[model samples]
Target: MLLEKLRAEVLEANLELVRRGLVLYTFGNASGVDREQGLVVIKPSGVDYDDLRPEHMVVTDLNGKIVEGNLNPSSDLDTHTLLYREFPAIGAVVHTHSEYATSWAQAGLDIPALGTTHADYFYGPIPCTEPLTDEAIGGRYVHETGVAIVKRFAGIDPMAVPACLVAGHAPFVWGKTPDDAAHNAVVLEAVARMAIRTVQLNSLAGVSQSLLDRHYFRKHGANATYGQKS
Candidate 1:
């Protein structure tokens, strides 16, 4: 019961991925971290989303050892843990093979910021990480998966851009909370789909820096004015 609320939030976030068509079958996972407790709550591996429950969420230490739950933790648990450990601002992580976003990942291409929709959620283009080496893939694949993402963000701020594509894999998104991470995943897919079409129409199409800054700042940070104020 230590992470009960966090478990529920992670459960709901997982279901949101299914509801939004970002996940099919059991192809995705969602997790939330309790930084104060140094624990994480995540969906169990291979469990169908329709049957998932708050109690089914597996609790684990940041080192990826399970502390609670009867089921196995998600296969992507290491990726979540590494992100939480390295990026202190991220409280949740979501991995999904949503069509358009995964397509970009498989192609090892970034989703270009073609319009305000892309810029609104992502400060710039959604980056795709470099392909993993055979050594990395043959070893601790999951842990190295996290390392690749962290490397891709070497000079980037995780909060400013909350998502990335793993070459030949899928998309991983994070946020200040589990629900927020799931929301960003949805937006990533939407914009990814749009970007695909935009490029098809005009390969050189791109959003200007001024327009990107305006849309991104208006909805985020201290100066944000897009939604109802808390």
Candidate 2:
């Protein structure tokens, strides 16, 4: 148990995705990084949720090398690791083919900040990455997935948005901890579902920058006041 607590947190986050209906069958995975020890604990690849336990969580180094565990790490380990390396502020990552978000991704559309519900979590539009080039796809598809995501956030603060929807794929969400990542995943799905309906009602619908800034900053900005003081 190299990362005993991180293993349990990763397990719980994976289970949370299933419970929240963000993942289907064995289609998605969740992982947590212990920044200090430079280790990651992730859900075992393709394993059924019902069969998972803390021990089944695999431990790997930052480069995706297995340090402990009998099972293979999630296939998206490289993407998770890249995010950990690039976005040092994040503590955990969760990837899911959540229906609404995936729909936007498949359409190669950004989920717009159509209302406060979306602005409350995502500061602006939830971005969709540019599709991977054929060369990147052929060479190292999984690792390149992370490259596209990082490219999309070139000038943005990853902490401000905390999520990215990969073009023609699905969404990857992260936060300060495994539970926080899971929570953000659930919110991402909710807003995405709402965005679809909002668009149908009015294609011109969108929140103004002033309102977007107000809602986003109220909760996530330096002087956040949405919830009671921590």
Q: Using TM-score, give the best candidate's number.
A: 1
Q: Give the TM-score comparing model 2 with the true structure, all chains together.
A: 0.98
lDDT of each: 0.94, 0.94
lDDT of 2 by residue, 1-230 (tens): 68888888999999999999999899999999998899999999999999999999999999999999999989999999999999999999999999999999999998888988888888888899998889988998999999999999998889889999999999999999999999999999999999999899999998999999898889986788898985
TM-score of 1: 0.98
User: Which regions in candidate 2 have their CA more than 4 angstroms from the true location?
Assistant: none
**lDDT of each residue in 15-116, candidate 1, tens digit only:** 999999999899999999998999999999998887898999999999999899899999999999999999999999999999999999999998888999
Cα error, candidate 1, residue 32 (Å): 0.1
Residue-pair clashes, model 2: 0
Tell me how candidate 2 scores on lDDT.
0.94
Point out where model 1 deviates above 4 Å. none
